[model samples]
Target: MTADARDLARWSETLAGIARTGMAFTESLYERERYEEVLHVAGDIKAAARAAADEVEVEREVDHFVQEWMESIGEGVPGYVTPKVAIGAIVGNENSEILLVQRKDSGIWLYPTGWADIGYSPSEVAVKEVSEETGIECDVSRLLGVVDGQRMGFSRFGMYMLLFHCTATGGELNPHPLETGDVGWFSRDELPEATAGAAWWGSMAFAAIDGEQAPATFDPVRDAIWRTDDT
Candidate 1:
């Protein structure tokens, strides 16, 4: 979208207000229908702003504003907010065994990943998430790509995923009960059934194994990429 900075800021503020109100209702004893109505309005406002801006980045910024507002109110609300950031890794050894984890929530396999936190860069978030979820200390080698994952069901609000090719520098595999249920290494041909919403890995696997860098952003909702070749 080509909106001026001031206009984008205005729309972002409005969307944030809507999110705050919805969060407040969720915190209270509001009925499910009422809560859903509020969320729908928030989504509509976001859609309108995005339509005006005609830019994926603009829509993502607005979505982040809404998520920040919801997080500020607290986390009692169910499915009201999306993860701000996430780190996915391609961890392997000389034997080429890729690391995978089973999430406690869905019992599905996935790479070590988690949401971004305040004061952390995307790369930092990725490293921290990998360590926190799987206890494998990794150093990020390169940024493979950033892809929009809203359609993958991986995000509740809206999310941009940063996938990294990383090396396991040290540390043994230790699972965290609060985040992961199991951890292990597997070959590419022996990949496990990933939990729903972990679609980022499938794309990353194709990129890493083929030695290709998908250095463009994807809009999952539209099934289009912001091609580098495009002006």
Candidate 2:
């Protein structure tokens, strides 16, 4: 009977983005007032999610989220709120092994990934992340998937992950001191028990590694776009 914490967070963020964008383009005083009210509601929703997730009583500081959203508002095109982008590499070697890194922050194993850098292309970010996090040099072969990180539980915030299929070119299994706890080649059957989002991406990744020609994957459209998980 209760909304999931993640669903609450998602709804709160979506509402906050809408309010911020409305504030950006509207000059009418009444519309501005309404948008501000929406921001307050969004803040309440976010605070609720935080409380639920932490399993503790949270002080409902609606003003904090409102101020944060208000500060992020920009003029015109830049005001359009969108999910952040991250790039991931599914690097495969000649032995049909995938390169995975144990994230230092979470201790979960996943393909090498990082936030998209300002100057580099998406594919370039994937290559850079692989080399930096796992010390694996790889050439991108093709795109594997474009995944919604929130839906897949890879991130709490809205993020789009550009997953690329890559072939290992060189380098040894040297994990980054700060970013990765460990790094190594793993066969499909040998993935770590703590592998993140394996159900959502495992098949696609291993198929790519095994030389299967499949189109890039994405989340399918929901029948009710705005419906909550409980519905």
Instruction: Using TM-score, give the best candidate's number.
Output: 2
The lDDT values for all models are: 0.62, 0.87
C-alpha positional error of residue 220 in candidate 2 after TM-score superposition, expressed in Å: 1.0
RMSD of 1: 11.2
Candidate 2 ranges with C-alpha deviation above 4 Å: 1-3, 54-56
1-231 per-residue lDDT for model 2 (tens digits): 134787888888899889888888888999999999999999898888878877545564667778988999997778888899999899999999999999888899999989999999999998899989987788999998898887766576779999999999998889999989999889999999999878878898889999999888899998876787558
User: Distance (Å) between predicted and true CA of 195, model 2?
Assistant: 1.6
* Per-prediction backbone clash count: 4, 0
Top-lDDT structure, candidate number: 2
Consecutive 10-residue window with the lowest summed lDDT within model 2 = 53-62
TM-scores for the candidates: 0.58, 0.91
State model 2's lDDT.
0.87
- Candidate 1 at residue 80, lDDT? 44
